[model samples]
Structure formats: C-alpha cells, structure tokens
Target: MPRPLMHRRHVLQGGIGIAAWLMQPGARAQVAAEPAGASAADFWRLARAGGCVFLMRHGATEAGLGDPPGFRLDDCRTQRNLSEAGRAASRQLGLRFRDEGVRLSAVYSSAWCRCLDTARLAFDPHYPAHQIWPALNSFFQGQGDAAAQTREVLQRAATLHPPDNWMLVTHQVNITALTGAFPAMGEVFLTRADPQRPDRLSLLARLPA
Candidate 1:
C-alpha cells in the first residue's frame, strides 16, 4: 500500500529553524564537543555530583514550520506528529539511558506533542505519569511566557525530598530561557537550581542530538 501523503498542517509544529541553527559550523562544533567523557559512568558521575536538572529538547519531528496562527492545543491529531526517525530516536534514547543506568526520579515535558511523545517513549515505563510543565514549551521566535514558567518548574524541582534527579523534555526556547543556550534535538542541558543565586547554574553537559 502506498503511504499517505504528509500535509503541511500535519507537520509537527514547534520551531522551524533548529536545523539551520544546528548546521552552522560553530554550532556543529559545539555539539561535537558537547558530550561528556566517553564512558557512561562518567556521565553518571557528572549527573550525581551537581544534582543538576536534565533539560532536553524533543526528538526530531515531521514539522517543517512553526505553529499556525490559530493552532489549538487540545487537538494534537490535527497537528504535526512525530516522524519515523523521531520515533526511533526516542526509543533509542530510552535504551541508551537504561543501558547507562541513569536514575531518573521525575520526568517532565512540555505540552507539545513532540515533547510529550519524546517523554512518553523515553521514560514513561520507568517514571509513569510524566508531568506536564508548560514552561518547557518551545520559544519559537523567542515569544512566550517561558521565563516565569521555567522559574516555577525549577522551584518545584528543587524542593523534592532526597533530591532525586529529574528529566525535563522541553523546547529550545524554554531550555534557552533557563540556560541561556539553545539546545538541539535530543540535546540535554544539566544545571543546578539554587535560589540564593538563581542565575548561578552551571552547564554540566550537552547530550548528543
């Protein structure tokens, strides 16, 4: 059977310029040098030391442009969905995390389908009922109430007893708002949330895309 044609409306809608941003020579170099030490143990050790939050962008999607002017949040089926590559990538990321024995106490994601899908495929089995944190939504064209939302999420994550590690799957703008750096697809930014110095977070690592 022939595959159904993909429509522009069905294109996963979030940010459109990520590929161009990532393709920049400097950006490519940054990503290339972003990963931590070769061994998974090294990555775990880094995650443990700082008790940082893992902020990730959604996996690849079929969307070619930003959301339409009248996009409705409740009707995801009418919006863009994950591409085959994206679905595979999400599963692979989950497998990698499992193999690495990364302990995640909480899983949070943006309300967008791509982010939600990534969180579902990547961590739902381990951390059921992944929470939706709207602040983690994409900041396309840098327009949104992302900063306030990010602060609220960070505040909540900090108060968790025993200080368990958290994984937040969000969009570039939300991640950038918190870290002052734009993350590529599948990239993760680890940072500590300290109220005394709200802006004193450190960049532990930028996971591979």
Candidate 2:
C-alpha cells in the first residue's frame, strides 16, 4: 500500500520543529523511542538551490532481484517489472513532486523496465523522458561499469544551476555507487557533487515518496 504523503507546508514547517526537545530531560530517550518521519521538504530547498541531482532507486518490483535469468531489455516480460503497489507509489511520487513545485529539467533512467516505468510514471514528461542512459543502468549483474557511470552522472550534474534539477531513475547499485547511500525501494535522494572534488557526491536529504 502507498504510505500517506505529507503536505509541502507541513514539511517545511517541521524542518526544525523538534530541535529543542532533544536537550530536555529524558529527551534523548524519548526521542530515540519515536518513529521516524518521512520528510519530503528538505530536499526541495536544496533542489531549488540547484547544482544537484535527484537519484531515485526505482519503485518496488516483483519478487527476485537483478533480473530473471537471461532477461532482455527489449522485452519487459523478460525483466522483473513493477508491482501494482509500485505503480501506485510512482504516481503518488509524481503528485508529491507536483505539489512541491519541483520541475525536473531532465529525467534519465535505466533501460530496465522497472526503472523505466518508475520514471515514466513519476514524471510523465511529454513523450516519456530520456531514451535510457546507460550510466543509469543496473551494474548489479556484473554487467555495467560503475566507475564510468558514476563519472558520467557527476559530469552531467556539474552543469546544473539554480532552478535546474535532473532526476535519475535507476537501480540500487547505480544509486549507491553515485551517492554511497543505500536507498529503500522507491526512495529518492537529493545530492550534489563536492565543489572542489566533483567525483564525490554529498547527500543533501532523502525525499520520501
């Protein structure tokens, strides 16, 4: 099932709402006991500031990892596709972006169907989005060049400026390679390359869908 999404106003308002509570008695213990909130606000602030890329681990998929043996990119049937729930999540993700007024300048995705579908549903750009960028492809099956892909992504991101944000929908390994952050299925990360060292990416925040 799709989890409930928060309104944009609520998130920005709560961005720093709980800071003082941590300093009070039993605060650490009490705070430790609280459930985590899925925040969608922080990333927008950085995204609007630009020079960043949004890396999304494709939405949930059918059982099994990587791809079924001998899966072909040309046929979605050959690959593990998105589950119904994943589809729903993707649509909600789009709504979240729309609500937050985050317009993607470019949408890139892995050739794999699950990744493709996730981006297709989330952004739904005119005539779909990019025609698949190999750099966004999954390297989990010992197939892709992680170093090369990461470099390409970093190089592309370097050209972004304020009001320009690109979205990359890919597999877990691809995202992990670029940001060193393990994203949950369907989760998004807002990241920017280090100013001095463009090779390394700094995670700004995790944007929940």
Best by lDDT: 2
Locate the minimum summed-lDDT window of 10 residues in model 2. Answer: 30-39
Clash count, one per candidate: 1, 0
Q: Candidate 2, which segments miss by more than 4 Å at Cα? A: 1-39, 125-128
Report the C-alpha lDDT of model 1 over 1-209, residue by residue, as the tens digit.
22234344433332345454454334444332333443445556766653668888888767566566666668776555667887888888887776766677888888888888999998887655689877776656545654567668667656644346788898765665566566666766766666675643445566655
Q: lDDT per residue, candidate 2, 20-88, as tens digits? A: 323333434422111134345567766667666888988877766567788899999999789898899
| Sequence-dependent TM-score of model 1 | 0.73
RMSD vs true structure, all candidates: 7.6, 10.7
My TM-score estimates for the predictions, one after another, are: 0.73, 0.77
